[model samples]
Target: MGRLALEVADIFRAHGPAWRQSQQGQLSLDQLKVMSAIEQCRSAALGGHVLCCEACAHTEIAYNSCRNRHCPKCQASAAQRWLEARQDDLVPVEYYHVVFTLPAPISAIAYYNKAVIYGLLFDVAAETLRTIAADPQHLGAQIGMTLVLHTWGSALTHHPHVHGIVPGGGLSPDGERWVACKPGFFLPVRVLSRLFRRRFLEEFDKLHCAGQLQFFGDYAALANTTAFADWLAPLRECDWVVYAKRPFAGPAAVLAYLSRYTHRVAISNRRLVAMDARGVTFRWKDYRAKGRTRYKTMTLSADEFMRRFLLHVLPSGFHRIRHYGLLANAGRRANLAKVRAVLHVAPAIDSTARDLEATVGALPPTFVCPKCGAAMIIIETFTGCRAIRAPPKPRGAP
Candidate 1:
């Protein structure tokens, strides 16, 4: 895919100032930081590096990236490094993609109480999975789950959902063997749905009672306990969304799956079709529709588009990617060791110093000059926010 001349950065740079002015008193500090980071990312404002090829004298200037998690431009390299670290954690087994979605009513509340609500989303969903799995009627084992929080739907709407990557099996009760679920099936979605709904709604009630949730706009009345309870009454009566998709074919497929969701932003730059006086045009999938009609383009006014994009900006230091159950940080390593032992799986191949060098050595373009195919070496170093005069004209005449 060809890079777009205009990016989300460009949109932010072109229109962000006015948007900020319009919402001067309303935008959160975290949201403002997101706007500024995206606006200045890879631009001259962030400073840059000048790279010169020793072999061909080819030169280029590369700007510094903001490296913000929300930036669409910076996620690729971050995903790659994360994948490398996680490569060793993959057990040779089937994995399932499960989703736990917040109902519309709760989603509305989540907009104002993001940190509290979203944190509970991760906690409650994870507990639901583990609770069901550990019961004797179900799998009766402690499972591992990697949960990712996604707050946007296909249309860039404020649809809050958690996507779970779960291993198809778990360590047995006695810790003696691996207990695998049915080859193609995971937990029952209906059962999962019921439990997830009960746990989250119950926890939400607790949050409200403890004065943790906030309200604004039409939901301002929810700050009162009775109104909040009345509002949540409909939610208790309605079915919550929980789905367990078919198992991934293998480990490689699991990696491919993680790549799509792990570092995803609300929208990628590639989906952007155009930006003009009328509005911004972009592609979206209508999951509710069928056949060719499902995939189509949409246009929104510049202000509205930015509004939707900013809606998904997470609270500062809030983790969207989390590990729980056996994958939880506190005891994950020991748990995985037992798992691999139970399965009799060999130790994962760890890359050595030489192996790392060889891996990098195998890549030609990263080290080679693109123009003349000559190997490039860094001849000098310059710090950011400073001008560098090009390498003394290669010390030769024109």
Candidate 2:
């Protein structure tokens, strides 16, 4: 296969050292580690193996992946594995896509308080959905949702938000029937937006009062409780963004959507256009524009590019993807079973054994001969940055 013309790793390998030096004392350990991983990913520094095709004698060298979640190259396999695990969890109902975004002010503070504010975003969003869905005036059912947090916009700027995949309906409070949402609509976005604003601010205030928030730079004054409250006042009245897209066509479409969003990084290598003395150029969406005009390319200096990329390195151990309500891990299986029963549909086949076998057996071999369609077997392995020596000659060498 041909090599990619550009990759985030290429940029990191080319300029990370100088950039890291220039930003000394400012970069976090996590950000530094991400830079290191991306630089070493798929390079000899990480080690690799040699594969030889049995039928054609075609040889190839494959390097190991860094497997860092922040590395763009490493997320594809992770996403696939995650999607496979989620297949059984998919109910037959239509799935709605909802997004809850932080307003600009909160998003600014979230950089320093990522763990706290992001956790609050997930919790408050989930609570808002459950609260509204449980209210008799609304859907009045217990819903399950999977939420994925995206911390960057197309331009690699900090724009924290959660994308939620929710079934079109929920289980009735009595648990005897499925509470299907009105055809084509989930809940009112206006109601969700109003409640999300209130609950998020309420929880945010509690965090401030409890001294869980940290303020830095221009926000240092926010350490004062009164000042923080004053800053948050306008946000209380202004609307928080909460919107629902039209329902996905079916479970298949939902899976396709999740594959694209669930493991996405701040930017993918495919989006990278060029790197040169001018800087790195890449594609970004100008959401305010219409039709084809929305697609745009932007260039940023290498330092700025690396800075923007590292801006999204999440705090250690923070869960960016979360499941709530019926989808909560502890009770997901039972809940899905119940929902299936209520829908009068056959329960999702318990394919644990089959899935395991298929997962192991179904995937095509990683190494294939370029000249012929044949599996390639590893002939040798090497570790670290060591070179791969030629394979040993047969015992009866000429």
Candidate topping TM-score:
2
Model 2, runs deviating above 4 Å:
355-362, 386-398
- lDDT of each structure? 0.88, 0.93
What are the TM-scores, per candidate, against the unseen true structure? 0.93, 0.95
Model 1, span 1-398: residue lDDT tens: 34576688878888899989999888989889999889878877787667677777998766678999999999998998888778778999899999999988889989988999999999999999999898878888889999999999988999999999999989888888899988898788889999998988899999989988888888889888888888889888788889988899899999988988899999999888889998888999999899999999999988999999999999999999999988998998788888988899886666453477778777765446667777666554454564567866655679
By summed lDDT, the worst window of 10 consecutive residues in model 2 runs over: 350-359
Q: Number of clashes in model 2? A: 0
Clashing pairs in 2: none
lDDT of 2 by residue, 1-398 (tens): 66689999999989999888888999999999999899999888999999999998999899999999999999999999999889999988889999999999999999999999999999999999999999888898999999999999999999999999999889999889999889999999999999999999998999999999999999999999889989999998998899999999999999999999999999998999999999999999999999999999999999899999999999988899999999999999999999999999888877675667767798898778888989999999999764579989999997
